[model samples]
Target: MLRLGSPRRRINIGLIGMTFVLSIFAGRLIQMQGLDTKVYETAAANQRTQIEEIPAQRGSITDVNGHELAVTVEAREVAIDPSKVPAAVRQKIAAILGRQLGKSEQEMAAKLAKDRTRYQLLARDVDPVVATRLLQAGVPALSTKKTYRRLYPAGDLAGSLIGFVGDEGNGLGGMEQAKNTLLAGRDGKQRVETGRDGQQIPMTSSQRTEPVNGQDVRLTIDRDIQWAAQRSIAEQVRKSGAESGTVIVMDVQTAQVVAMANAPELNLNDWRRAPAASYVNKAAADVFEPGSTNKVITAAAALEAKAVTPDTVYQVPDNIRCADQVLRDAHAHKVESMTFRQAMAQSSNVATVMAAREIGSQRLHTMLKAFGFGSAPGGGVPGAEAGLLPDYKKWSGSQNCTVAYGQGVSVTALQMASVYQTIANGGVKIEPQIVAGTTDTSGRYVPAAAGKRTKVVSETTAKEIATMLESAVGVEGTGQLAAIPGYRVAGKTGTANRYDAELGRYEGYTASFVGFAPADQPRLVVLSVLQKPKNGHFGGQLAAPVFKDVMTFAIKSRKIPPTGSAAPQVRMRAGQ
Candidate 1:
């Protein structure tokens, strides 16, 4: 607006403008390269670096003989970078992956349309072979991450005992849940520079932390013995049309559970389809009134207290009144005088109750507690219930007499088994064990610490009770069906009225048999229990045969020979 300048004047103005522009450039360069150099460098590195998780392998669960129960197999997880996928080939890539991943083409297309998303999961736990094949197809933007999936090779053989895993690779129940920390290893991490093709740059500096694989868990259960026990119980449950059943076999010397099986079991591989009730390890968790099978406790109590000798005699009645209640025997019979051995062999509730009265409530309670009642069995079994045994102070006169013959008190199957195991082990009540040990990274097994031992009765008292138990399984007793050929089997049959909470009264019956073989020198104790049998409710009729079948198998499996002599005969009637 001023006026046209001369050529020299115009040149001076242009030089000043150029100097101002150069000044701005110099200032900006200094601010970026000198002041915020680290900021720029970090930004560049972030674009070229990627951090990834390195998963560690979970441990395996094996049986006593090293048979695999639960194991982890190599697998892969497929993912997609939707934004990186080329638009022209999105449909084709989606179609190819959809077929292999069991997804619909429409679903895949919809996922790929999320262009703003950097990554999307296509499939998890894909078979490694299938993942490899998919990768070879050259599907754009498709990627794979290594992973593992748990598999149970034994199906549901010991399903409830072995337990299953959750989607995130955590143990959910049974031995798996109990030993999760030892079985789940630590995860690792890696950070490295990536090239434009999303591949790690060779010879580049990187950081990595190695993972620790989990140790193996070895159980004391023998697979073959477990199978035998399972088959026997299942067959009996089906034949008797019982609601359900449980069987437990334990080694007398170690008190280690050789077989713990429950009927209505689910295939562990398909645990998702199992009913909620089937998930419970009944042998360890469920409790019931042990019925006359608990008479052994009374017998042992009386003998140990010196209240009565094996030859002590009592005038038994079909029904006896005790504190506003009349307790009756399983069958009505005329009053008869009988020896302690005869009362036990015939399973006379009246005689047993009379003997218990002699022992007194407090002494009887002490014996029960010493035999591992009213407490958890401490077998390292998760969810093992401490069976219900009311405090002696709360015991009414009726309750005291009822408890003498295995009523009013509750016990888990494992606890009942331990009661017999105590006698079989010569009065030393060893804490039961399920998990034998755990393996190291190098597959060397470190045996578990020994179990605690408590003396429940004198060795002599135990032998005396064992002799009476032997007579109970002889030719003239209620538990005769529990006898094995050529073996002096010792056991008791229990038929207890099942308590129904809704009805607020005892309804139905729980048939059970608990015993050990070769009474002279026991090796194994087997307990079989059936709930609510439709065919027959008596323990001798419904449960004893199952015990015999399972006990025979256990005896043969362990290669235990028979006792050379027959069980000593006992008086079956009064004044014999």
Candidate 2:
């Protein structure tokens, strides 16, 4: 059926036609496939195989006993690729996205209308219910993807301590910020080859890197004890009408921080409503003049120097003068000369000043430093403050008297707790710790090192001090409010008036109490500081009760077996 051209004419015509057609085809192919490949191929990949980040699930945070503190949950993020959408459906796409995201359609449309950006985030951390609804609708240009979102299982139980993450999964405070690098995992990429009809090229996948999941962190906190301490403090804060309160508990044996609770906590899951102060860990941050609590150091120094004995009786006096300073007790009674034990039991400021004066500045400074004064607790967290303690050479005539009763120096709640813990642990002052351990991918834990210990006082001296503390908590002492029903308590009450610099005088007072319970065998050490309490200003009336409540709750929560014993008595040296 083919028609053959005239021999001469057909050859020339056919050759010319074939040359023109071949040249046209080659030019069209190069233009459509080479220079334009990037744009077109990207478009094709968008439909069939997206260039996306595959996020690994962040690890969990647990308490020392494997109690869950913070965990991760799957969340959905909705996005829109506006350029791929048909212009006619723009209004519909905007309406659907905006309503689902709690935004205005006009605002969403304006964002999607941008030509420069290929992808626009419509909503992040969307609830699964909304994500399901959006996905079911399947509006053009809209897409939903899965992501790992942090969640607090304990609510506000340990909120401030555990901390929370931000929208970009970055930590902002607490342990979240401290362990961010370990919590956030590495991301990965994939470039899958696609077939002609927008179908993924199966079995020809390209995955360049694998995601490395974050490590798990465990804290030294005991959840039950933490809950108990927090609840007790909250109850007391409400009942007493104090401005604010803080309580910290450390183990007598290990010196590990069992619980640190502050009132007005921020929710670990929802920190937006939290006040700035709510994020502050007051136990380790706020410093206050440590009233009569400082007397213990003075007493210990005198004991170490053999300056006085439990029965080394002193003459009775209504008041005493340390150079220009006049020292007196809360209640005045000119009794016949009382023994040193009786003087400590009555919490006589004059007696404490005398003890400090006898010990001298050098011995006092050594004892204070040994008690972890003028130093950081070194918990490895940011914002730790080292409280103030003047050196030995800095002591003047009145310095010994004022510092003896906790007036001249300042200390944080943590530092004060360490002071009490030292006495409880047989004079071995252990550094306080917050973090317990961090575990790698294999779930094997690497425990944090136990804090260093320093032997500050002798066991006999520690026992003597414990005996005096016991008398202080018994029938006729200032710390009577700190006694637990079933066990003996050893504690000191502090009532230091806040010094006003502008007015050059003391105005209000800060009430605090630091002590250990079950005096025979120490189970817990509790430090309670109530700032500017409106109802009453005495440490005995305010802070002592708070310490009692916290200590009782902590002991019960830890299920410490009650030794069920009577208080111990200190033996005075013969013929002192």
Candidate 3:
């Protein structure tokens, strides 16, 4: 700057200055990538690499015999890349999308015409063939994402019990909803390094936390028995023109619910088309008047209080008054002398009411509570209800008499089935268990033991009740239709009209039969309930036949032997 220079020297000075500026820029890059390496390296890695979660697959649902009930399979969701399509081909694309995705052709065309943006999910669950056609047709907009869809191999067989999944592949109903946490998978993720071009570099400081898949759930349900029960109940519902129906079968000893099914079932594969009512598991959720079924509980209370016995004679009248309530038999009867057992065998409401009176209301109420009425079965199934049981202190006098005969009290089918199971299991009231096992994330199996035992009635008392029940299958018994020839049958028939809230006075009826076969040593306890049958209102007529078919299959299928000698004969009907 102090010396004057020739023109060539000045030009060379300018050129040297420009070269020095370029060198400074290159040195700054070195500082960032080398000298100040940590700072820029952290910035670059943060900008280029991102941690993402990878979801593990959920476990399968199987039956007691390891038959797959519900399983998840990988599927795909397809979207359209509208921005890549030409305006000239928009209508063709729209028609193609309409045929594939079930979208309105005109609406899709309009949307394509107005938008150049990439379209996502213009279609989903596309058939592979359709996708191939799209590719062949050179439809520019289509993309796909791998996803999962739940498939029920058994379909409507155990849909209500196993439940169905939502569109998002999450559990929505039944066991699916109840054990979602144990049955659902969790995605895990970690940091990973990437190249400057946004490409992942294998084995380069990747932080990976593996995902844990959900546990496989095994239930006590028998697929064969479940299907049989569902078919039998559905056929009966259709034939009898009943509003609905439920059938339940439980192992007498294990309290394992072998089969529980309801009519009007929904196909799990197409659950969206099923009615909401079909989605409910009537066996666990619906509560109804026990009708004559309550009489058994009344008898239990009487026996417990030493108020009566099978031989104890009671002056059974056509009607009896306890407080202001007049108890009348469903059938006409005189003030004839009848033994307690005969009364039970005949299903006499007056006799049970008198016995309940002797036991007193408070004691009867307590026994009912202990028998698991007024409470949920704690079966661990979802949508289980604790049924209605009015406290004795709050009961009207009529409530006592009506409750004695199963009129005022409410109970679910599962609850009612368990009560009989307790009697069948010699007074041990075991909790009903459905799930058998569940596989953990590590592939280890966890056993389910919800059938914990607790004693309610004495064995001697249980045997007496069992004997009294057997008499119902006798010729004089109202439930003679329930008798399976060659095999002893012990069961009670219940017929109660549904009290209409709009127009009182017992509008419709629910007929039900709860019984055990080979009465000497009960193997299975089957309960079948029919709601509002158009053919007949009697349980023996409407539900007993279904029960017989179910029990017969159960007996033959289970290979249970006849109780006694002389080859007990099953009476052949006149049909064939």
What does candidate 3's lDDT look like per residue over 1-576, in tens digits? 697769998899999999999899999999987899999878877876778666556779898989999887765667665666788888888998787767899867766765556565665555666666666777775666555567788889878888887866578899888888887788667677776433478877777898777889999888888888889999999998998999999889888888988998778888898888888888999888988877778888888778887788877788887776666887886677888878887888888888888978899899889889988888686787888899999888788788888888888899999989988888899998888888866888888766778888888888788888887777767788888888878888898877655575667899999989778788899999998888889887888877888888877777898978432333212111
Poorest stretch of ten by lDDT in candidate 3: 567-576
Q: State which candidate, 2 or 3, has the greater lDDT.
A: 3
1 Cα displacement, candidate 2 (Å): 51
Clashes of 2: 0
- What are the TM-scores, per candidate, against the unseen true structure? 0.93, 0.84, 0.87
Model 1 Cα lDDT, one tens digit per residue, 1-576: 787769998899999999999999999999899999999999988999999888888899999889999999889999888998888999998889889888999999988999899789988889998999988998777789998888999999888988888888899898888898889888889999998868899998899999888899989999999999999999989998988899999999999999999997868888887888888899999989999999999999899888898899999999999899999998999988888988888899999999998978998898889898899999698789999999999998799899999999999999999999999889999999999999877878899987899898999999998988887887767898998989888888899999866688987899999899889889999999999888989999988998999899889998999979866766666667
Predicted structure 2, TM vs. truth:
0.84
**Backbone Cα, N, C clashes tallied per candidate:** 0, 0, 5
Order of the predicted models by lDDT, top scorer first: 1, 3, 2
Candidate number that wins on lDDT, 1 or 2: 1
lDDT of each: 0.90, 0.80, 0.81
Segments in model 1 whose C-alpha atoms lie over 4 Å from true places: 1-25, 83-98, 102-116, 195-198, 501-505
Better of 1 and 2 by TM-score: 1
